[model samples]
Target: MSADTADGDGSEEAVADEETAADDAAADTYTVAVDRDACDGVFACLVRDDRFREDDDGLAGFDPETADALERSEASVQATFTDDRLEDARAAAAACPFDAITVETQ
Candidate 1:
């Protein structure tokens, strides 16, 4: 997915960044999910956003105060934000090398 920014002549073009591509493809509908079972307790996602935190068991979990506790067995919707934070959210997904995090958009 790529975006087309208008130039002097007003033409469309494609961008290379996947994060921006995803955002451009789906502007309003997007969410991020994390699989607790698949989470390796790595703190990479936590560092990237306020959405994730270390649970009592030292595993990656949603920040209790900032987020509602999501289901652990499946893809848990962690956080929702405006377009400005979309890139940061995408970075969080990428930070999880274990592939426990997933981003949903239409």
Candidate 2:
């Protein structure tokens, strides 16, 4: 009933909310892919998502440190992630001038 007790209750609720958010983020999964044949090394995706980086061949690739699973081939690169950054991946896909980037929820 006191102001101090109310503040304590609010703080506990805030922590619980944060934990729920983290759990939701961990449950979400998605995949991002880059078509090597279509990509022109414009780096447009890099600006929207730090997870997208330039590879040794001067094309778009995924940052291994950020990706939960990464696969690279002669024609494309794909990365799977389980996090709350799906919108960031979508933004990068939408920013690609060559339509080389793709993001899919999994």
Candidate 3:
């Protein structure tokens, strides 16, 4: 039989097919980039994750260069895989009243 056709056994092949379909629909990587130029320093994202912080002036304060480096080497806000609800990420992205947080999938 072909991959597109399923047997009545509901066996490993069926599971594999479903898994493949899910993988196909899923994105390989995710990126959360803050457009600091447009950032209003809203701390909503900071409140959600300590990785985000504000400057002494109470504006969005995380170091982009540092964050970019960390994200590339270690912890990545974008590449993080979450079976948990994407609520936090989505909230962080939306919390930017200034539209600074941009989340993209690839």
Best by the TM-score measure: 2
- Measured against the true structure, the TM-scores of the candidates, in listed sequence, are 0.57, 0.76, 0.47
lDDT of each: 0.66, 0.91, 0.56
Task: State candidate 3's TM-score.
Answer: 0.47
Candidate 3 positional error at 79, Å: 9.7
lDDT of 2 by residue, 10-34 (tens): 8889888999887776656889999
Ranking by lDDT: 2, 1, 3
Better of 1 and 3 by TM-score: 1
Instruction: Identify the runs in model 3 with alpha carbons over 4 angstroms from their true place.
Output: 1-28, 61-87
After superposition on all C-alphas, the RMSD of every candidate to the true structure, in Å, is 8.5, 4.3, 8.2
Tens-place lDDT digits, model 1, residues 1-106: 4555465542333443665777665544456677777888878998897777787777777755543234453434465433445566689889898988887654
Q: Cα deviation in Å at residue 106, candidate 3?
A: 3.0
Better of 1 and 2 by TM-score: 2
Extract clashing residue pairs from model 1. Answer: none
Using lDDT, give the best candidate's number.
Answer: 2
